[model samples]
Target chain A: MNETIQHLLNHRSIRKFKPHQLDQETIEILVRSAQAASTSSYQQAYAIVGVEEENLKQQLVEVASGQTYVADNSYFFVFCIDYHKHVLAAELASGSVDQTVETTEALIVGAVDAGLAAQNLVVAAESLGYGTVYIGSLRNDAAKVSELLELPSHVVPLFGVAVGIPDQQPGKKPRLPMDAVFHRNTYTDDDTMRQLLSQYEKETSSYYGERTDGRRTEGWVNQMAASMKDPKRTYLRHFLQEKHLSRD
Target chain B: MNETIQHLLNHRSIRKFKPHQLDQETIEILVRSAQAASTSSYQQAYAIVGVEEENLKQQLVEVASGQTYVADNSYFFVFCIDYHKHVLAAELASGSVDQTVETTEALIVGAVDAGLAAQNLVVAAESLGYGTVYIGSLRNDAAKVSELLELPSHVVPLFGVAVGIPDQQPGKKPRLPMDAVFHRNTYTDDDTMRQLLSQYEKETSSYYGERTDGRRTEGWVNQMAASMKDPKRTYLRHFLQEKHLSRD
Candidate 1:
């Protein structure tokens, strides 16, 4: 396999980082790497804000539900789903586009664009000897992150990713069985999901030795169980509607 | 500065592919590379259906708004925003432990997860000497696509990508200036956007060389206008409701 393929096959997320700060040149390389990612129809329906301020990172930490690594990281960024540019771009064509670009489809496009770009940035950072961790909990409170990032209406903060040099390496997180996902021409599996997850649960439960913290023994199934609990997304629809996204 | 960066920078959606078939090992490598992508919470919240049957490919061509190359490509994979597993996982967890998953967040997570993984697959494919094109119009009638794919509720079709050896090489598709999407610490530069896009709009406008298809002159602005004017999105909410995404 080629280097990029090899990198993709061997994947891991590094949450712990060293105190070393990323230089401006390195930041430029990452941003350029991000920009090189494919956008749907070149609409470029996303934007990112480099977080270099200590106070701002603190506020982001609070907004992201106390993921303190966000504040402690050497380099941080917030990726956004933006349609305001198209609204402005369309303004030059005729009038303000009437349709709300906040449909599930639109959100999917923006989120995917951001997601695709963020992955490219991840590999690029790793290539340069930097560590990375994606912050999906940033979506736990959309409005606060938007306000903290000074995001304009019609541009929502999808997620943030903290980047820095490695201080500690997190072991590879276990995944479900390959057959559970990789269907041939159609999606079919005779094996039960419980069986697949059961094997993973056993593997993960003892994978890491016990820590004082409760997260250690929780294992993969327990983690999935925890994720299943409602996060009170009432703020989400309200935020999207207030931001003028949703259906007309 | 590196060959990978150079390859990334030269990305273009290729519609025409040579009739050569990709080996099963290559498909495994590509999917493995895809699985290696960063998934939110490692939920792996997506599914890909590889298309090999000519009859199924023909139906997909129709679902993708009659893109003939979709059926003609060497490898066709449909990416999905799959929350069915989460729902099932939730059902099991809730029955055993009394918990429920957040549907909207799961949907968003699935799309972003699938999109990121698919992008990695694209890069890996290109690196392995293959051409690719994303079929976004698959959302034209999502319900139809779902029915055709035997997709359960909570599994939305995000997009399809066709991959193969290049029968034709295409030039890079233009993109908006970095300033248009990259903000410093926060989003604040309409002026910066206006300046950069003005030049980019010109580049994209001449992209097709001013052909007779009146749309050839629409440029980015015109395309946005035309998209906004799309009445096909007329019953999008009702469609999602029927699909049980019920974002309402």
Candidate 2:
């Protein structure tokens, strides 16, 4: 990995922010650089709402499930996967169009497009000496977010990104062993899975200073449990369906 | 956009492929570069499977609804929105886990994770002088692809990508005006839509070239109409549901 890939590999979510503000020029440059990232089908099926207003930012924090970083950050942006424009395009081309994707796939794609763009934006920002974090919690209540942002019917909040000058230096997070992620022709859940993860967990726990200091670090599994076992897991689909996405 | 972003900006599906073979080294480099992309929380929630064995590639071609590029190309890879490893991790943590996302937000993250990773792979391959096209048609029969790839339940085939040296330079595809995608505080899909797109369609049609042009050409709207009207256009959600996706 050279500098660019190295930068990506060594990325960390920096939540600590100084009270400094990002200038308009810098914001424009970052978004344009983000705009430069690849979009599927040139459908350009995505949008970025730069959160600026104080009350709106507070509402955004609520939309993001009260993640303080979102409201207080110097540079905050919500990346949305959008098909409203495509709907218009569809209508223009062929009167009324059947929405084949429903809201599921459409909303998923919107979030994905935005996430991909945000990833690129983060890398670019980091290259230019900014700290960043991806706020996936922004989707806790998509309908509310849509209302807050006055989003159109075909748009859904994918995630939020916070960027600014670093307030602190947090080390990079450790990844699982390559085999865990990089698999052969199929998926495997072998006993070797846990063994492969053993070294990674140790490395990760050690990096987090949880190895020597007995902390509740169950490693990847624990994190997965915290994340996946929530009742709200499938909530976005309903919200998406509510928004007329049948991603069928 | 410059040449690099221009290549990204004008991306399209090149279904026809010349009988060819990509050397193992280039293939390795491409996949490795893909692996080098930033993974969320360093979880690396995606995988790239090379369809090298001709029989397997043939099956994938059929699986992609007769998109010949899969079997005929120098290369093909299925990008997956995978949470299988994490699911296993959750099981290990709590001694049991659900096969489906308990939350719609988790689904959103997994989907976006794959997209972010795939876009990186695309950019990396393009930088290495490879021509590429995305195979969303693969999603036309995601379940068939899942069975063909012998994919485990939680890992879904979000899309496929085909890459090779270009036999022909596909023309640039225009995007909606920047304002169309970049909403300031909110989104607007109203009267301004028709007025702006009126002339742009002419530009899009011109780019498709004259009717005598050897290549099949359809303007975006017409292309979308064909896609929406195509029987395959509507099967994805059914495939997902039949695959036992529990979007509670």
Candidate 3:
């Protein structure tokens, strides 16, 4: 395999980080790499907010439900679904986009745009010998995050990425089987999917058991079921609507 | 800049592609790279469907509004936000996830998962000297695309990526100014955003004029305003809800 593919295969989330900070030039390179990602319809419907202030990072830590890494990382970035710029563009062109900006399609586009950019940033940071972890816990209290960041209408925080020098080497979590996630021509039938998942559960159970010295032997299916049994972030829809997104 | 960063900066979407099809090994490497992307809560809420059959590719081309490249590319992959495996997992654990899977938060997670994975696949393909273009037009008739792919419940097609040997070297589309997209500590004020956008409009207008030899000189703001004045894909929400996603 090539070095790039090898690097991708070696990815693992690093939670603990050293005290080192990224230089301005490295930060610029990461952000520019993110900007190079593909945007839908050339509507770059996302923004990156860099948080370096101690107080602001602490507030974000609380919003992330006490994830200290939010504040401990060398750098933290909040990826947001930002249509406020589009609103400004509309005003300048003497046009109204109220109807369009509030659609569910718009929300999906923003989320996808933000996600694409964030992944690019993560990849770039990893290539530069930095460790990164996606702080999806920001969604635990997205409204608090939005308020803390002073986000405007049509702008919402989706997630964050914390990058720094690695202080811990985390094991790579095994993913689902190739046959399970990669379908050929069409989606696999339910029976075939179930068989593939059953096979995967055994593999995952072994992985967890070995990793935790037999303390955590639960398989992928059980873990997924437990998490799926309870709804999470139920207020997200209402919050998006309140922010004038996905109102339709 | 590192080689990876330079590669990312040189990205440009290719609409035309050579007739060469990718070998199975290359496809496996690309998909495996995608699977390595981070997933929120390790949900892995997405799947990739490879389209190699000429007939199916033709059907997808029709779904994407007659974009011939959808069929002409060396390979096409439909990235889907898939929770069908989660449903199966719930069944295996004797638990129910219907309530959780229908929530807006679930939809957003799935979209992000799909987008992250798609971006990784794109980056891997480009590193391997392949040209790629994202086909958001698949959403133009998502239902038809879904039906053609035989997708199941809790699975929705977000977008497609057409990858192949380079047949054309397209100019890079200029993105927004760094100040416009990258905020510090908090969202930028409206006045600063307006100024940055005005500056960007001039650059974009000049870009379009030079590219088309003065035939297409519209600025970014005008283009955005015109596209945003009327909503597109009003049927997406209804379609997603019908697929048992984001119903809540």
Candidate 4:
């Protein structure tokens, strides 16, 4: 019932944004709010690259598989899992840095921290009546995005967020019931999953089919199956390795 | 200036929590708020396992290297990157699921979604006058936590959240200046990083030295250097392989 929880619950990805520029002060506040989120042991293993140049934004639009919002939004920030700075910090504090610091766990910490920071930015933006959407398609060609942003070793662009004033209000998307995702002490039994999923399919089917005026008939499961039938972003492992982020 | 952003900016990880259990309705509302967070392509690739049993909490505390907060918190929930349900959904919609669906991108999606969902839960809990802390140390023995939770294939425990009423108010931790984290069109130059980090080290040194009453002389960089000297959680890559989550 409170405004804070209401803002959290009322979130919807905003794709259509008005052609307005965010003031420098507002953008700075958003970044500060992001930094306020909890970091694992305060390593702060993430960085945000805000792109305002029209040329670079256009290139990123192409790199993100033609997400025009990347070019049109008031601000487009690519959030990267950044450990390169920590490596530099270690070297400055100690004589040398350890190679073992590039373990998978370290990589996980960067990615999770990037996520935590980006989500905070989203909530803060929404609270201020600005709209935001995450650009996961940036990973469609992450290397190009990283190259454009001049990312060094131990840093990789994970996703982008486009923020601006809203031009449209999308209907709230329905999520799976709590029984499906919230388990008690342990994972739910298979029988319970089956029942819950069946109900979910029907609910999703209605949402998609009716909302789009029969333009879409597939339910959540079917759409996911189609998407999963083919491989996606298979180059990620090789890319992570190239960036020295996939140490064994 | 708003309550939502104020709640976010005021966040501090609470280790000392009052011994009080959150009511079931409040917990349900928190989980619902978590589900409301944005997901990539509507793929809700996360699940939360609420652990209230004292015995399981004790075991998790041991798994997390005796972080007594895990055992003492009123509620502890293991947040997981879960694609197992998506795999099942794929199977239900189609006759078979593609093994290629378990690519690193898919894993990243799951991990990022888990982070987004968990942050929402934290904010929601905070809105209701609760304190929250993330336990990344759960990954210190992720395999054991998985085994304890009976997690199936393509599912991994990313972290844990300890939530309860606050027993103490810790000073807000200092973060890197916005100049360091929020870059312009591209990442800032090295000279900028060095200058910013020098300032950061001074701030953090004062914070740590003052907080522990001079008992801990190590600044942020020194502590990070010591922790990074040896490999922590080296078994994660192999653990991912065992869970059938390692695909290129």
Q: Which candidate is the best by DockQ?
A: 3
Q: Which has the greatest TM-score?
A: 3
Better of 2 and 3 by TM-score: 3
Per-residue lDDT over A129-244 for candidate 2, one digit per residue giving the tens place of the 0 to 100 score:
78888877776677777888898776777778889777888765665665666555555555766667666666666665564476655566666567556445466666777666
Q: Is candidate 2 or candidate 4 better by DockQ?
A: 4
Q: Write the per-residue lDDT of candidate 2 for residues B169-231, one digit (tens) a residue.
A: 654456555566666666655677555665566666667766437375556666655554432
**Residue A11 shift from truth in candidate 2, angstroms:** 2.7
- In angstroms, how far off is A156's CA in candidate 2? 1.5
For residue B207, give model 4's deviation from the true position in Å: 1.4
**What is model 3's DockQ versus the real complex?**
0.89
> Best to worst by lDDT, what's the order?
3, 4, 1, 2
Better of 2 and 4 by lDDT: 4
lDDT per residue (tens digit) for residues A117-179 in model 4: 998999899999988899999998999998888898888999999999989989987899899
Q: Which stretches of candidate 1 lie over 4 Å from their true place?
A: A189-191, A206-219, B94-102, B206-218, B231-234, B246-248
Candidate 4 positional error at A230, Å? 1.3
Q: What digit string (tens of lDDT, one per residue) describes model 1 on residues A66-154? A: 88889887799899888888777767776665464766556667788888788878777776667788898888888888887788778
* Candidate numbers, best DockQ first, in rank order: 3, 4, 1, 2
DockQ of each: 0.52, 0.41, 0.89, 0.76
What order do candidates take by TM-score, descending? 3, 4, 1, 2
RMSD of each: 2.8, 3.7, 0.8, 1.3
Instruction: Report the poorest 10 consecutive residues by lDDT, candidate 2 chain B.
Output: B1-10
Deviating ranges (above 4 Å) for candidate 3: none
